[model samples]
Target: MRTLALPAPRRSRGRSAVFLAAAALLAGLAVAPAAHAGDGRKAEAATLHDLAEDHGRYFGSATDNPELTDTPYTELLGEEFGTITPGNSMKWDATEPQRGVFDFTKGDEVVDFARAHRQRVRGHTLLWHSQLPGWLTSGTWSADELRAILKNHVQTVVKHYKGKVFAWDVANEIMNEDGTYRENLFYKTLGPGYIADALRWAHQADPKAKLYLNDYNVEWIGPKSDAYYELIKQLKADGVPVHGFGLQGHLALQYGFPGNLQENLQRFADLRVDTALTEVDIRMVLPSDEAKLAEQADWYARVTEACLAVKRCVGITVWDYTDRYSWIPAFFEGEGAALPWDENLKAKPAYFAIRDALGVRPKKT
Candidate 1:
């Protein structure tokens, strides 16, 4: 039921990033940074991930198993990002499709790829309400039965990838937009204590791994974030193992950029918890024009700036690096072009914008 995903692997669209660049130029925009003769080799090769490291942060992207077949896509993904998340590979349905049985093949492929590429892996989720196995969702269970099932799943998954992953979104999207606990299977069966329990389980499974509570639409200051503020505060007071708050930066052009995003992240940092833009993507209406693309670039810059502005804002991860594998078209009608690179695997204005935000520049010849 994670409706936001419809990941079609390697369905590349469009032609000629040169055409994209020409259009951008005609619209009076500086295109993404490209290799130049006079540029130093190190600067020329430095990627977004490298630039982010200069700021002491990591730049990452989410990837799936199938997209690994795409040579060009995988090449850029591995080169430009320092971290990767298995978009759906690590979810409950994919990991443990049967009661008392676990499968880590899909998730392991991603981890292996990241390891080969020398990139760190972030375990996407140990528990979620959507994309659940039929048996678990269909079968009925009492509170105690459900609690044991939940605990086993969380700890087993966390331990399986124990030393490989540096972080785990122990629970995901467990809050309603209106700032109420989502009455998901766990919440309804085991009560809100499930979050604390899950976090503790993950911590026990891998003490070094960072544990996070992830949700979308909490980027800006609002009732939804207010709810998380109160929740995290109480969790800290109660000595829960909550370590980070993930703001899934899934934004739409029509909604306008989130207000006071830096201040919002700052407040969370003030709570002595780490913060990250877990899933960054900015989608726009279909038939995207130069203006829309430019606007998207501006938003990317702003988000990067906001994260850089905060000391504890650890890192940023695009939902994926390129629109070739983007989920926007499948999930949001008449909305696409949600990533820094277009479907052609060529960087766009947004890519350069992000680089500029990270303080990278092409030295003049």
Candidate 2:
């Protein structure tokens, strides 16, 4: 949160041809501006299960094309999952891998799908240290070049999506595990001030969109979490237009989840901004580990209950809808099945636990 002036750009080695091709396709698409239906009781009538509810701001998920039409995500979720993040559809590398080039075809598909279904969208991220084009990390551009690139990238994407997206994770995973700032390509090239600039630029692109700074492991009170807390306070004081904080609640049973999560959420609410339990999933070893499964269910219930208890905690989004699509196993190596539903689209025990925690009564067949 400390205001650091923008630093000099590192360098850029250039981008890949494949990345550039995809980016071009995104830029060429004819995206019509989204129409705001306004907030009203009629909009609220579409219960969280109706995809058209547009209120209560409950659960959301990162969806793909196949799932958009064929899976239970569209059917079972209905209006309940109002907000949609592009699982991996709108990353920096995907949107604009090369210089000055922008591609939003995949992301646009998501937007189109959401619009067709009458669901709201949350832009997954605008800036992040991960999943960036190799050229960005190559460190070839001057500070000026990088700044222009960053600004243009943000402006273009925001302009394209504008009213279609309700909120955005403007800057992601900027803090280190110790709660100190992590020096990624942006930080290394542009310095600490880049965070504020990113937020400001994103706001310029779409003033209506609620911008948020997102990170994982901030659900508990610790050095890292505290660092983010202080950072938000400082940004708020600076009048940065930062409207919310996204707690990437990716938990593991072995790590021993936060003991005082409800208190932690209240602290953020006290700051008078919205909060969301983004990318939530409690993972354990597979092959039906009943004891660990039970523990996972308990943890899921706790997270859901905590979010519900906090007034400003608007929504909770699982990383993936089903274990089959979960990124945990690939990322965590040995971690498996980390979602409310299994690959077969059957509800896991954790699913029922979360539903009950949310005060949602199961429908009798």
Candidate 3:
């Protein structure tokens, strides 16, 4: 899960501190020509999906069940994107509220929308420490008991959406920032082997679906990312079913862009697996100024370029399309506007910058 706002700038003390200070240099990269503003007027244009498709990639966004009823909001999602990941619907809490029972109502809604729009679907997560049902979280179980439950959960969820989803984040945010596994329910009960077990179970249920281990803060080469690299490398050696590594590219302008982001993604690519910017949003401390917005746009363009540059980087997905429902403000005080579109669904500079980065030719009006 994404952490709170970045720590305030501090005097360089070590490698991490020095890397954090490099945000300024990252922001100084040459900016792309900005595209026209998204004025909410429907016009003939090269949509992000079309441009990305030309480059063998799919552009996507995450949407929640509540946003489905908003006609304009859904319209934008259906038109401008090629893939949809239900932000919370497919999580354990929403799927299996009780021990044995399962619910597909919320997740089905998103899948239906994607089908209607001819967009692909990505299963958000099967195992995550957060947003779990009370039943699973409150009760304690032995290692064997917990392992059985986890297997059942993974198998059942993967089987239910077998043919529908193209990729599944089998595990989410299992690693901490310091390159260690977080002591979550599964880790505490079953230990680190749980990751491999989760991936194996998911593959057993749906061999066709691409299984992935997804996390945030590993967009660059750091302790956190290094841990993932080692883990993924080991998994590959063991012939595990780990198919992809997801970088939940939740970025903030205050914290400089990740160092060697392209190189970091390339390293994962060397493992012969796919990579994606699973949940991308560049935020700044609120009351956004022109400079901050411009910087945000630059970051967006750079992220798109980074993915495009890497052959194994499949695509990029924003946390959501518009800032009306961004999770940043709710979690981080005085921080919002983390999306390419504004609360009013108007395309900000970042939107056009993305089009430029994707090499979309301007459509004649």
Candidate 4:
């Protein structure tokens, strides 16, 4: 996280005919004011998803099973996003609480919602260090025993959701901040080879679905990202089926923005794997002021622009759309207001900034 001044907003109204057609779909919805809200600037009619689709990218948000019951929440989720991730439903504890019994009731709810809205789905995680079921974490197993268990879990989940989920975070947050592998249960029992094994099992279950290795704090070309660079390179060399890299862009104002984000993504693109901003949000110290909010907007714009600049960078997804459902304050003590929309579901400056980043150009008169 390094500090840098945000660039001024650029203005140009010329746009493609296709954009104008798509913007018409935004009519009647509560989209924020145009990039230039007042000042006689023409209004923007397209949703963030609509504008993003124009560039062959998707704008998405993560939704939990509980939030699906909220009508207002679901309405904005459907209208604004082109893709969705199940925040916790697809995790091990939720999907497979019992040793061999699998329950997909919650994950299915998210997939069903995504399908109804015509939005693609990103399967949040197949393996991770957190939120694991008590049975799996508490039990002791030999190398062979754990390997079998891991494979079975992956294949069952992938096959059950086959052809529904477009991408799966086959592995998540498996690296340490200093570029070493994290000693999670899988690693402790199965050692480093487990990474390749997990990716392979997931691929076997569904060859069509893209497999991604996701982590946080690796948004720049640092030791952590460097570890992934080498790991991915080795995976490819060994003919593993890894297809993408997910940089969970969880930023904090106190930490500053990631350094050389575009450059970092480009290096991964060189490995022929797709990249995405998996869980993006810029949180600030509590009691948010105008200056802090403005800085947050600039960070949002920068993240979007970084993704757009890279050819292989597929899309961007906020942790959730509004601060109403944000997981920040709950975990980080006093740090909240991390999303583009406020708790009331009203658009913040970050919303307009994201629209601008997505090429929401007004028509040239």
Candidate 5:
């Protein structure tokens, strides 16, 4: 699971969003003259989630089932964020291990944890190309057969957690980096209509859950983001229930910052749908040094600032919030240290940067 989103700008944002930001700015200037540099003691007791809520947003992190048993890790996760996304529990393979029969055991653990912590849950995904159950992936099917299977999977999963989950990544990473459809199982079998149908089916299951199209590397305005912009506009025109767009802010230091980030988010806000950074983590080439860490911190702050600047951009969720269980080192060898917390759970420069970006300044002792 991951968080994806874009950068700043209200750009004809809703009246309420504009008013809140303006009011917060005015109040910040009155209380702490150095507002950009530091926030006032009003937020001294605030966790990352608290600071986000101050601006009518949420701060969240992704967690997997195994880590839930680590009391220390779970403690911090429960305390720090207002929302959570299960890294793998809610995925296709985990939920429906066998055909028709479903298993909600792993996903339920996360939902229960979130309930106990008073946190909102964002369903990682209802559909994706990867991680399908062996039966579904191995079996052959015609368009009609596959469509029914897909509808069942999406509806059953969405209906099961109806009120518990606030949003659903109805379809994940359906686009290629170059802006073409991924031609995945759904795409090849059912054609491009699969996306619209998936969203529709998910909505039917849980009409209230925000349906989203989630993808990585769409943080900036380019071919990929452009495709989503146009597609979303079309969906809205066609009376689709698509509610949000998720920019999986999986960034690397080597790649320069997305110059048009804020502008990109602004454009989407202009479309009147919500936006979010779903699986945020800025990784660097490893054997990390102070310079690299500082750079990563800056990137985190930039991303936070970007989200804050946009009105419909609702929230941000770091992939796991810590490097100890980071998916980077294993997935991308020779690369690691992607999270704000160290292996031992120590706050790194990136952590302070995010807190500061969220407008919190610890009370000087």
Candidate 6:
């Protein structure tokens, strides 16, 4: 692959003052050339796979993170992978940080980038327990107020981004680890109907976008998995506009990857909704153990292969493109290097492995 010039990072506002500094630093780093000579556009065009971007603080472009540039994103685009999942760009807190007051600046920028590149946008998480503002959980508002607030929030954000976004993780991580329904403020206040209502409202707001129910750990076919299966079945039976399922394949090299991921994904596809391998990344402990690195590569290949084999599995999205910007280290102490690319923007063995799995020859440009 030939080398390409990196674009200067742009600035974006965050909910907190601390993120402003972090975003600035990211912007600066984004423009520096991360690729070697003769490896810019030519090499990237050769080896690039059409995969989706995992949106988060690290994956945010140079503008959003001063240290990084839009070159990587453009490289990915050149590779023919045009879909992106806003890691957290459209989350409840980010979009509606202060209740009725909605913010679409960051999310819009991402959408605009996707549009400029002719890429598809996945609107992540219309509903989730984490990253929610404190005001919603204080239990201070009446039920009617809460319902009005929730309805307004969904309608406003969805309508604002209508047509630009192709799909949405309408509800995320609603089930608990123990296979029971998690008690989120919306559920506690609005009851089970809220799930259906949220979906209904989202469908009404943007009828074109595909709405999905996203969750982690459903890769396995055990009790927790059973709970999700039944929940979706019920939702479908109730005639909800739920169109897809997002399986977050956050794998670890130490523990074995889920035994029957293909079969599990197939079962969901049998329900007639598309499935996606969302937020995929295999983590390894630091110090760069070769054995673990090899294992991680193998895991990436297998997951990519599985997605390809599953006809309904639209695409696979890595949580981050490179290790330098991975959320694993900060979120999971001592864990690092959780992506197909290394921090220096070099392809790891996993990159080739994924290409092999996708049955695409590396470009010789």
Q: Write the per-residue lDDT of candidate 1 for residues 108-203, one digit (tens) a residue.
A: 999999999899998998899989999999989999999899889998998899899999998899988778999998899899999999988889
Per-residue lDDT of 1-365 in model 2, one digit per residue for the tens? 11112122222223233233323323443122122334553422333333212225467777765566665556654344666778777888889878777889889988987787777888888898888887777768878999998898888888899899999999988998777789887788788888889889988888999888898878878777788789889888998888899988887766666767888888988998889887888777655565555556667777877877787888888776788677777777677778877787665666545544654432345
Estimate TM-scores for all models: 0.90, 0.81, 0.89, 0.88, 0.88, 0.80
Per-residue accuracy of model 3 over 1-365 as CA lDDT, tens digit each: 59533433433223332233234333554332233234552333557877787688989999999999999898888888989999999999999999989999999999999999899999999999999999999998999999999999999999999899999999999988888998999999999999999999999999999998999888878788899999999999999999899999998888887757899999999999999999999889989866667677778888998898898999999999899989999888999889988898877777767876786433445
Off by over 4 Å in 3: 4-44, 360-365
- Ranking 2 against 6 by TM-score, winner: 2
Clashing residue pairs in candidate 3, if any? 23-256
- Name model 5 segments beyond 4 Å from true: 1-41, 360-365
> Compared to the true structure, candidate 5 yields what TM-score?
0.88
Could you list the CA RMSD of all candidates, in the order they appear? Answer: 6.4, 13.6, 6.7, 7.1, 8.1, 11.7
Write model 6 residue lDDT over 227-258, tens digit each, in one string: 87888888899899988888887776655677
Q: In model 3, what is the error at residue 225, expressed in angstroms?
A: 0.4
Q: Per TM-score, what order, best first? A: 1, 3, 4, 5, 2, 6
User: TM-score for model 6?
Assistant: 0.80
What C-alpha lDDT values do all the predictions have? 0.84, 0.72, 0.85, 0.85, 0.84, 0.68
Backbone collisions counted per model: 1, 19, 1, 0, 13, 34
